[model samples]
Target: MIEVENLTLRFGGLVAVNDLSLVVRPRTIHALIGPNGAGKSTTFNCISRLYRPTSGRIRVLGRDVSGLRPQDLAPLGVARTFQNLELFGGLSVLENVLIGAHVHCGGGLRERLAARPPAVIGHVEHLLERVGLAEFRHAQASALDFGRQKMLELARALAIRPRILLLDEPAAGLRNREIGALDRLLNELVERDGLTVLLVEHVMQLVMAISHRVTVMNFGARIAEGTPAEVRRDPLVVEAYLGQEAAHA
Candidate 1:
């Protein structure tokens, strides 16, 4: 559903992503993994149009994404969550998720200010329930614990009704139980809802358990791309992580 061809991103003398290429198939979970500074996040930014590539091409569902703004991608069925939480702390959970529905809203500011349609209000309630935050719909975003806050973020992203989801380290800093819940949520997203996922994560346990394919990078270049088992046994992949011991530290 997403393709990056010979992608390169450079900042003056610094090359963050160097001719990296990968394809994420529809209805599948594809993982991009590497030690720090390996350019996983850079590649994600390119796909999300937060950063334009210095060279090469990115295609989403066969349409080239060049020149498209980040907001443009959302209407085309793309949604993403940041590695860090990006919720509005002062807003109620329901209000924060309603912000994501702006792409689907047809009315102008005046209409919105007048009131939300019943359908829109119901949709937000459903989303809160789906993310296990039904009772917290009126709770302040900052009042929720960290794990619930993350789920709130996920609910907001789902409010976009995306065909493809890009997640950057969704498992980071979560408790084991929270990660397990996330894993199940992801499985349902793909297996039941048919959402394609492209994830950049350091949690090998989550990546290997959930991803159908894994791509490993080192120094801004792809070193291995294959099934989780294949990547786990790859000599170069092993070397890349072990050589940096910093990966685990």
Candidate 2:
């Protein structure tokens, strides 16, 4: 559903991402992983259009994305969550998620001020329910635990009704139970909803347990890309990222 060709990015004279390319297929979890400074986040920014590539072509269904803007892509069914939570602590859970619906809302300021836009209220409720946050819909964002905050972020992204989801470290900093919940939710989405996922994560346990394919990077270059078992058994991956200690695991 998403394709990258000869992707490269530079900051000043240094290349942050070097000739990277990959394809994410529908209803599959395609993971991008690497050591720190491997340009994982930079690659995401390029896909999300937060940073234009210094050189390369990115396409969604053969449509060039190099010239497309973030607002332009939002309506095209691309949704993403940050590595760090970006929720507004002051807003209610429901209100924060409503912000993700911006791309679907074309009303002017007056229309929003008067609450006269089309009825997406049902859509909002449905997203809240999907993320298991319906009971906490009216709660303050700050009141929820870190796990729920992550789920809230997930709900916010789902509010866009995306065909593809870019999730950056959804398992980061979560307790085992929370990670388990995320694992369950992801599988449910893939199996029931048929959503495609592009995940950038460092947690091998979680990625190995779930992802069908794993792409490993080192020093801004893709060193290995293959099925989970293939990636796990790769000598370069164990030597560079997982280490011999983890190789035994």
Candidate 3:
């Protein structure tokens, strides 16, 4: 569903990402894993047009997305959550997720501000239920637990109704149980909803178990790309991922 070719990004003396390329298939989960500063997130920013690459190409469903804006990317089938949760602490949980549907709101800022009417309230309620947050719809965003907060982020991204999901470390701060629940939820989206997911996560278990394909990177370059099992067995993957000095050190 997505293809990136020879993507390169540089900031003055540092090359954040170099000659990176990969593909993600429809209705499948693909993972990009590496140590910190490995350029996984930089590549994501390029695809989202949050960062302009120095060179190369990015295509979403055969459409070139190299020049698109955050707003333009959404309706062309792109949505993402941040590594650090970006929620409106002052808004109610329902309000935060409802903002995701901004692209579909079909109205300007004035209309949204006036959506306090009963009609708007009803639609917002349904979106909350879709993310399993109906009971906390009116609760303050700051009151939610970490796990629920992560789910809220996903819900907000999904509110855009994206075909391709770019989940940036969705499991980063969660416990094992929360990660497991996330695993199941992502699979459901892939299986039942036909969503295509490209996730960058550090949790080994979730990355190893849930991904159909895995791409390993080091120092801003592609090192390996294959099925999860194949990648795990690759010597370079093992060297970079398992060798402490190569990855964590």
lDDT: which candidate is best? 1
Which residue pairs show collisions in model 2? none
Worst 10 residues of 3 by lDDT: 240-249
Q: Look at candidate 1 and give me any clashing residue pairs.
A: none
Q: What lDDT does each candidate get? A: 0.89, 0.86, 0.85
What lDDT tens digits, residue by residue, belong to model 3 across residues 76-195?
878999999999888888888777777666576546544554655566676567567889988988899988898899988887778999999999989988888888889988998899
Please give the ranking of all candidate structures by TM-score, highest first, separated by commas: 1, 2, 3
Off by over 4 Å in 1: 106-115, 242-249
* Better by lDDT, candidate 2 or 1: 1
Expressed as tens digits, the lDDT of each residue in 1-249 for candidate 2 is 889888999999889999988998889999999899998989999999999999999997568999888767778888999999999898888877777776666565334323524466678888888777899988999999988999999998987788889999999988898888788888888889989899999888889888988888888889999998888889999988988777678
Write model 1 residue lDDT over 93-119, tens digit each, in one string: 988888777776656534442456678
Q: Clash totals for all models, in order? A: 0, 0, 0
| Decreasing lDDT order of the candidates | 1, 2, 3
Residue 121 lDDT (model 2): 68
